[model samples]
Target: MEALDTPVLDNHLHLDPRYGRGIDAVDDFRRLGGTHLLVVNKPSWHLDVEASEGGDFRAVFEETITTVEEASEALPGRAWPVLGVHPGLVSRLVDERDFSPAEARDLMQAGLDVAAEYVRAGDALALKSGRPHYDVPDAVWEASNDVMRHAFSLGAELDCAVQLHTEASDDLTAVAAWAEDAGMPRKKVVKHYAGGRLAGPTPSVMSEKDRLETAVERGEPFLMETDFVDDADRPGAVLGPKTVPRRVRWMLDEGWEDAVETAHVETPKDVYGIDTRATLSR
Candidate 1:
């Protein structure tokens, strides 16, 4: 396939050197014409950080920043970091660690504060937060929403985007409301692992033919992502790192050059305030 002129940015991705391909996975994407990506921090357990306090999350955030730095060195100015507590940590704290719902919520909110510090220090570009995608008790659900809103507050204060991992739903109106309530723009609340039917919040749709086509046809600005878990145990679980660039090539082949520019260049810039063209030029 011919290399696309537009930049290919995977809005959500992971790299785990201890358990997965790590830089090699990133190299795969780069070799396939992926010029930019956001190396989002995985769950705390992925890095073996058993955090009972906010500062313990530092280990996870630092590891992610290191990965982004390595990726940028390989593909200059092409990789940025998004740091925050994974919403699942709430359940992990409550069930696995024996914390109460309120305690778990407080710890997670504090963890997000630590993530916000990274953004403040210019070490990260965005914060990741969302409620669980599975069934949970109402108390856990409420606590998770509180945690998500705390992230929004941090994003508002830091002037950065918040990438969310939430349940796939046709109506995300309440999520939008949460962002608005926290003084963050709804567009800055990126719905990671999203589909085309989301009614509110910016969608970071995975790289699938039907989903990409659907998002494009909807005439709403959205971002593209691979959601590569980068776990050796789950190789290519969600999608591969090469997916976005390959999808870009397909979009160009199918005469969706404008969509390529929109997803890769325009939407990312609008949401995260990062310019892929500028990154490429660097």
Candidate 2:
């Protein structure tokens, strides 16, 4: 309906070593006139799988949380981390050494239990997803309900959002499916691109046209996963940084100015749990 400016939120960004070089490392995240940058509230959670298998789960969990708290305090406003048990965390629980499907199922169920209490109980939102490429077991799909409901409740109160990767580009589908079981709020639901989509295909690659059309038909708001890292070359391409802006413009060109709300780039209100927002207005 209305033409908006170039401001947009890069919904999915990772603070890996490549991006987190120094204090001013995040300066580039704001290059496109973004508003806020949401990051992992707890990065240790993402790495727990490796630690659990090689080191100690209990120690890893404790160390991860502590590090997250400390980092959140340091960053203050640049990083907004979504907390929850990742599927990668569960993959560690199985400890098949091979990371088999059946083992993934058992660990997936455990993660739901952990998520229900730790994450659902005001810890953080869990960002778990299963990929057919990974050949993951059905257990993960079955356990999503128990985990999502808890995560959503926490997110609702904290004024935060949780994203689920259930094999779709539209936020509504992922939100609806999660709501059916977890009762998550649609208002907080944001659409995102798949992390591995760049390696395999574009969001519009296979079910691309359909998902884009569905988002248009339902007036669904879309967000970008612009930090996707490609592995095709000696050094993969950053498909999102270049592709996301183009897609957003394309959607606007196709007449979705109002239907698809662009996520404004923003700074984290707080780093870990610090009061970075105190400086900014509500």
Candidate 3:
């Protein structure tokens, strides 16, 4: 793989325990010129069973933080955590865990509280919370939005960034409006796994050049991501972990270096305050 002259940062990925790919994944990214990555903990398929059985969600949060810490120690400043209660988990709680609406709200609030604490302590970078896997029931969708609003409010209070995982075609205008209503800046919101059609003022992360060109043409700040699921069963589920570096190298080769620089370096710093230069040097 050809490395870019400048380093890149992947704003969203899953390096969870169940996935089984650990430091080796990190090393592969680094070798491809990936300077930093944000490890987002999306509640796995099995979390519903555990949470329903009275398993503490805090342990999951702690485990994610620990994994990120270990990765950072192994590859200094290269791994960071973005903790939150995935919105899909809310429906799972209701259907699988037999949680009432009130109970689900309570658990979601508690999870956000823990995530906020870590952000305040500088142990995490951002909160990754939003609707996942479209086609949810209307009630579940509304409830998830309510949870997301609460998360945005907490993020505002804590001055932490938020990464939203929603349908690629969903209107971000509403999302940006919600963020503004929650007293959070639109710039602090990132639309995870984004594509060409943008809906609002918030930034987005995408991988393909054509879509990236569309985002750049709109003059909106954006980042890049692989959204790597790390599932052996779903090889390159979204894109491989090293996809960003290779795409960035392609962009640089195609005379989009300035755009790539802004997306990979400046936009991440603006959104998450990650100083890649300083971080990599350390």
lDDT of candidate 1 over 13-42, digit per residue (tens): 998887889999888888888889899998
**TM-score for all predictions?**
0.98, 0.53, 0.90
Q: Candidate 1: misplaced stretches above 4 Å?
A: none
The lDDT ranking, best first, is 1, 3, 2
- Candidate that beats the other on lDDT, 1 or 3, i.e. the better one: 1
Q: How well is each residue in 1-282 modelled by candidate 3, as lDDT tens digits?
A: 554457578888877556557667778787787777888875745433256322366677777788888777665457889988877787778887788766776777677777888888988888878775668677777778877888899888988788887877646888888888888888888888887456663556568777777766766678888888776677666778778888777777778767887887788888888887777744
What TM value does model 3 have? Answer: 0.90
| Residue-level lDDT tens digits of model 2 in 1-282 | 232354443455444432332223234333333333444323334443443232223333344344434434443233344434454444444444555545544444444344334444554433333332243456644444444455555445444555544444322454445543444455354333542222211121211344445545643234455543322221223433334444556767897666335223221111122233342222
CA lDDT, every prediction?
0.89, 0.40, 0.76
Query: How many clashing residue pairs are found in candidate 1?
Result: 0
Give lDDT for model 2: 0.40
> lDDT value for candidate 1?
0.89
Off by over 4 Å in 3: 1-3, 44-49, 52-55, 74-77
Cα-lDDT of candidate 3: 0.76
